[model samples]
Target chain A: MTFALLARCGRTGRIGLAIASEDLCTGAVFAHALRSNTGGSVTLGGSPGRNNTLACNLLAQGYAPARVLQELRANDPQCESRQIAVIDRHGRVAAHTGEALTRSALHRIEPGFAVLAGAAVKPSLVEALVQSFTASAALELDERLLKALESAAAECATPPRSVGIVAFGNQDYSDVDLRVDLHGDAIRELRRTYDEYQPFAAYYLERGKHPRQAIPQREFADMLYAGRSGNTR
Target chain B: MTYSIVARCPRTGRFGVGTATFSIACGRRNESVRANVGISKSQAFYDRATDPLVLNLLAQGYTPQYALGVLEAQDPDFQYRQLGIIDRAGTIGVHTGRDIGPWAGHAIGPQCVAFGNGLAGPQVVEGILGGFMAEPDAALEDRLLRAIEGGRDAGGQASNGQPRPERSAWLCVVDRGEHPLLDLRVDLHDRAVSQLRRVFEACDRGHLRVDTR
Candidate 1:
């Protein structure tokens, strides 16, 4: 049950999420960010579920990182197995990995880069993945997300027998942004899949043909809606 | 006991070999024999020393014959050593030294070469190479194993089936490509070549286990 989350936060724009797991598709219970790049958040997979609705409200209310962390820890039922990576509009990023994650798991933290890679990875993977995206030389959010996946592959404790990558933004679009999956040679498979989708970004913009598959209704519609309707409204 | 090998698979257009004889600078001694040829096996008894290097060098562009020639020339007492080669066209070639211990010989066939020294007779290398060439369509790993079995049947090692512990044994092969698709090693094992083959199979299957989650 490896979990991950990646988002793009534009100062005056949107905050979105893209995540994938080794079990069911993440669409089941993944939550989108609220307007102002803060608010409710939840991502559930299988028997274990992760949510932070209260923490999002506190963050929106301008709570500090340390406070948010403390709030999260206080509510965590299985602190040792949980993991999280959060990046706010201000570029404030926070992460956590439960000790319960597999022993091979490792998290790396750098100024603009954070990485968590391992088998049975915990919440810490979010931090490392986001960091890799932030530090990559990719030109766009999509490219950054792809790079993060590559970084994860390079640092994975045991080479993932399979792999994938996903990304989302608060932009009000009618289509999904990214999705990748592989059954054989994850590195090569993901890279190829990413290439296939690359044209969608520009092609959609050029021919006005946005792909219907790219959009995740919850994040695209709700997240962008809240972001656009300022608190004053 | 220093061991060095350099060979090529003519049919597959691939070349490589690696050898080590429990001594420091073993690679250097083997290197002199290998010269600018295919590859030199100058290390502890590790698998892939010769095959990986051969495949890599072939990818870098070196003929099968020239590659084997370099290593052969370097060994002053060529008769006492072991060597094998398979050219780009699957032309097999090999030479085991007369000075080589009790069991030293080589076998050449349509597209395979097999040779070994120190326990057994020329029949060992001949049997393996003949069996390998006869089954040209077999999987690479399977063919390699068959060759090993042939060597064993021809009085493998000096152990005489006594299960004498050995520090090392090795096996290597090349895909029909520029780079070696697999390189495995077991410094110590009851059947180094066999174990190396198992690891190769695992790597091949690793990609097939996908996680759609």
Candidate 2:
């Protein structure tokens, strides 16, 4: 089982998700699709399929959060065993946890946030996500998402084998996207990976949009430098 | 930048080193193993000459300490290099340069010496030592992996307060051919340990490349 959050920052027009599980390479299975700054979807658990497009269309049709859930519930026959959550560009949040969920399964929905867990997680993790996300106002979206995962894991007193973070900022691409395939300490690994990717995030974004003028001439000289294989003295 | 353990099984005669670092391709930079002779981890502001020098000294049938001492005597800035080694006979030695980074030290155990520099705390070395000392009967590869895991858990190398996952991790074992039975490396990965483990698991199965040379 797994736990995840699909969120949109009202102030920044960004959307993202933070997820963790006992699985390997969670990104491959869980990340349905993202529509740049429009929204993102997390499709997971119990024979899940790509429902993110459904969510996007529902949002575009101007359905409220409750109506979005009701529409999705009526459309899919296998919806009972699935867990899906979403945040539209306008920051409306909604989620669905199947009635078949075990007692441990839990989920929460706020105005601009949704935290949902599969059968393997306790309800307390949802609380941890909310509290940590609220407390981490000063951090970047990626770091805030990570803090939420750390908080949930800490409260549960057991970390997952794999953790993934995916965020969409002003650009159509993810500003910070990473995965800890498996580790004894996935949170620390995730944090390290995020830090490494952070320095290159904006450079790559600018490079994508304005390939010629994006990077400084001096810095780009160093950037294009290739390192040799072994120590040379 | 890192710490490591180079050891012999004493039973199977297999030799190996388990190491982690903030630097890239640490195995290629710091560790050198001469088949049936010995293994060494020379690191932290690493000097390129150390790997060959250690291998040459071991080839000449020198003890770990005398060999390192002779190597240090030839180098003017010997105080900056950190090293730990074990010979075929299981003779062990460790050296930390006086001018090396803070939290640098070594802990000697039977058949192995675990040492680290720029570590988070003293426990980093202790954990490597304790893990190696425990389960003495396990395969050398398993034991080495365990030691590195312990080292990370206790606090692996870092200039800051809490130790973070390293940028690279390496594990290598040599058979009688002096060729690596397994030489798996996570040269620069966020989940270095985990990636190395996956590579190790694949190499451990009959899925290994036997160096022909």
Q: Using lDDT, give the best candidate's number.
A: 2
Clash pairs, model 2 backbone: none
TM-score of 1: 0.38
Q: What is the TM-score, restricted to chain A, for candidate 1?
A: 0.59
Which stretches in model 2 have alpha-carbon errors above 4 Å?
Answer: A206-233, B1-213
Residue-wise C-alpha lDDT for candidate 2, range A1-233, written one tens digit per residue? 57888787766777878888776545433233455656756767743434655666676677765676777778888787778776778777777877776777767887678888877677677888998887776666777899898888775546676777777766433555676655677777777666645544455335433433443322432454334233211
DockQ of 1: 0.01
Q: Give the alpha carbon lDDT tens digit for every residue of B1-213 in model 1.
A: 222233444434344443322111121122112222334332212222344455445546666556556555754434433455444444444555554344445555554545554444556566566545557665444455566555555445443333222223333444332123333333333454454444445444332132332
TM-scores, each model vs. reference: 0.38, 0.49
Enumerate the candidates' DockQ scores in order. 0.01, 0.01
- Candidate 2 A-chain TM? 0.82
Best by TM-score: 2
lDDT: worst 10-residue window of model 1 chain B: B22-31
